[model samples]
Structure formats: C-alpha cells, structure tokens
Target: MNKHCCNDMTYHANFKCDIHKDLFECPDKLIFFHERDNDYGLIIHDGGSSSIEILFCPWCGKKL
Candidate 1:
C-alpha cells in the first residue's frame, strides 16, 4: 500500500473499526484511498459507497 501524507490519513484510509471489524463494513469510515487511481477521498455515508476526492491531507495539509 502507498504511504499516506500523515499518520491520521493512513489510519483513516485503512481504518478497521472496532464495531465493524473492517473498513468496508464500517458505517462511519471517513477517508478512502484508491490504489488504482493513486488518490485519496473523503467518504460520503449516504447509504452507498461514495467519496469526494481530496488533494491535500486533511491532517497535515500535504499534497496527496
């Protein structure tokens, strides 16, 4: 997996919720990383998996 700009970004991108046990299964998953696209996004929990692409790290302001 590609390294994220910050630890917070990394953690969120690979989030494993204690309740859901998996990022994909978590209803509150916030950040997302697309390996194929090599980009990061903010997850939108609107009943389906959707996200808004983010250019900079929300935690560190680093270019992603």
Candidate 2:
C-alpha cells in the first residue's frame, strides 16, 4: 500500500488521528535525509536490526 503522511505534521501534538478522526498520535518518524530532488523517506526503528519496514500509524491504522 502507498504510504501517506499527515496534511499537517503537528497533528500528533494535539492527539488526533488524521485519517480516523480519533484521539491518537502518529509514531512514524520523519526522515530528513534526502537523496535527490527533495525525495525523502520515513525511518522506523527496529531495535537496531537490518530489517526495516514502513509501518502504519497505530492511531489511524493507515500506512505511514
């Protein structure tokens, strides 16, 4: 599934799910590193393991 970010990055501060319209906070970390043309990706911590996967926002239950 194609991942989607919140329309407003600060939505988590208010504890509101952008997609579900419920009280929740997104745990997905925003990646600042850019490769080319302002392309970016999210960083999901995996206990320092080589395995990495883009997880969904637990609050909204949507791909992050």
Candidate 3:
C-alpha cells in the first residue's frame, strides 16, 4: 500500500498549497464536497472508536 504523506498531496488535489495551505488543518476524513440546498452543518453519528479519527465532515463544513 502506498500511504501518502499529509505534506505531499493537497486536500483538493492540487500541485501546490492554495487556499488551504497555511490554514489547511487537514483531518483524516477531510474531503471535497458539492451539494444542493446549501445543506450546511453536520450530523453526529456513532462511528465506533479508533486511535486516529472516526468523524466525517464536508470540507470546511461544505464551504468548499
């Protein structure tokens, strides 16, 4: 398996750090998001436990 380093790949798959460079606090489940109705906020569900993280959220709370 080829695990990429945090400093290697950009959050939004970019060649370099852009908007989320300095302020990019990349979480384990951080990913891109695109939706309708502007469904903001989050929903907390039971996702078990882990040493890393088990939560999921849209990038920047759907800000992306």
Ranking by lDDT: 1, 2, 3
Q: By descending TM-score, how would the candidates be arranged?
A: 1, 2, 3
Note the clash tally of each candidate.
0, 0, 0
TM-score of each: 0.77, 0.23, 0.19
Top-lDDT structure, candidate number: 1
Report RMSD (Å) for each prediction in the order shown: 2.7, 10.7, 13.4
The number of residue pairs in model 2 that clash at the backbone is 0
Q: Of 1 and 3, which scores higher on lDDT?
A: 1
Candidate scoring better on lDDT of 2 and 3: 2
Alpha-carbon lDDT, every model: 0.81, 0.36, 0.28
1-64: candidate 1 lDDT, tens digit per residue: 6578778888888776778754555777898888888888888777676789999998999989
Choose 2 or 3, whichever is better by TM-score. Answer: 2
lDDT of 3 by residue, 1-64 (tens): 4122233223433333344343123333232222242222221223422222213323322211
lDDT of 2 by residue, 1-64 (tens): 4223553423332333356432212344334223243333343445331222335543455554
Candidate maximizing TM-score: 1
Off by over 4 Å in 2: 1-28, 33-35, 49-64
